[model samples]
Target: MEERTDMPSDPTAVDPYGCGCTECLTGEYIPLERATEVHIADMLAGRLRNHTGTTFHLTADYTIEPNTTLPELTPERLTITCPDHELTWTLATPRHRPLEDHHRAGPSLEYSDGSARVVPRHRLPS
Candidate 1:
């Protein structure tokens, strides 16, 4: 992927139509676990953009997991998936006000045919 000089250095600076971010312009994939709630919130708020130059809205759902904290505390899970694309991510976070979720995004890096190559989202055929 070719790096674009006009891309936004900060993710927040990019619009919902994710054309100006390094991920969108350069097809750089970041681990979902490294993503924060702010990133998910941005997606929910039509602030997070995808490589397609469009806003991707993420849906939040509650799930049950092993409670490692207090007995009264429960772990919450947030799953984000793109309906029109092969994109899915999950964030395991605490059920508190200041929620910090773990998530991973971007296309698959594993591609085997005869050579080693990573096919970016934009490079995929429609």
Candidate 2:
């Protein structure tokens, strides 16, 4: 599907609604990890702004696969699906913190046909 021209292109410019993360709550966007995830979630949210039937699926694995070419690196990704559009962002820089407990009540979630199930991947139980 074609993109909406009326939508804002810059993700950082967005001040999201009631972000519960420490980074957004405290406004202490630290060097990496937490701060970075906040940005990513906002960015994904921006892309899905006006699209109907949007599904945001997050993953627990932030491992970047081996890559010799800096530009062609395959890192962890955040994917968004809409009724007629899909965007998968390959994050060159993912989490630096330990994968186990860094993020999650639902560390990983799987989605198909709009149904979701939490995948407990070494995450903090909620």
Candidate 3:
């Protein structure tokens, strides 16, 4: 069963884009630059072990998706672990948000079921 989340509201937000998809938040029209969409759609990461940094093993693969049957105060979508660095992070996908106008021009969600690509083993640490 799909559950509705009790999302926090930002009193200062002014949204003007949305695509009426079952998986996407609805949008309106706007003349503002679309850059803000990335920041808004950013995954909320929660550190579980060591601190976060870009200096992780290049081979450290990560996945992000919700795999729960929610009863959550703060929903966790997925976890990413860097075994080499002994570091971990949990992430939550965006919800109750609006999609940008340009998003409708192409794929609804391109990486919906995609894997991340990184350099091959030849270039990564052993």
Candidate 4:
């Protein structure tokens, strides 16, 4: 994948269709996780964006590992491990507020086909 420095970092900016529920309003909400998964799914589905343009029909062989638990947070934090490579990310609830629903941010992801790739919370195209 080509690197584009101008890519948006905010999840909402990249994915317009959020988790579609209250599960996304707090910290790394379900909406965010779903959005992230959608991106990976798109990649696997061969739906690749220009990374610099609005064209959204690219193809690539990809795999997405669901969120796993990080050793640091143990049973509290939501972490996902990618067995394909050495990468892990933690999802925490918004500061001070507890998750209203069972919703929580899924694990952070790292993709390693040849290079290391971290899927941003946003930047997932529909």
Model 2, span 49-71: residue lDDT tens: 32123344544334455653333
The segments of candidate 3 whose C-alpha lies over 4 angstroms from its true place after superposition are: 1-76, 95-126
Ordered list by lDDT, greatest first:
1, 2, 4, 3
Model 4: per-residue Cα lDDT over 54-89, one tens digit each: 223322222223553332122233343343332333
Q: What is the TM-score of each candidate against the true structure?
A: 0.33, 0.27, 0.19, 0.22
Clash numbers, per candidate? 4, 0, 5, 5
* Minimal lDDT window, size 10, model 2: 28-37
Which candidate order results from sorting by TM-score in descending order? 1, 2, 4, 3
Which pairs clash inside model 4?
11-122, 48-58, 67-107, 68-79, 68-80
Best by TM-score: 1
Cα lDDT of model 3 by residue, 1-126, tens digit: 875454332212222223233222322212112213222222111111111222422222223347632222122133444464454443343342222321333112111233211111122344
What is candidate 1's lDDT per residue for 59-92, written digit by digit as tens?
A: 4454445753333332354566544544555544
The model with the greatest lDDT is 1
CA-lDDT, candidates in order: 0.40, 0.36, 0.27, 0.32
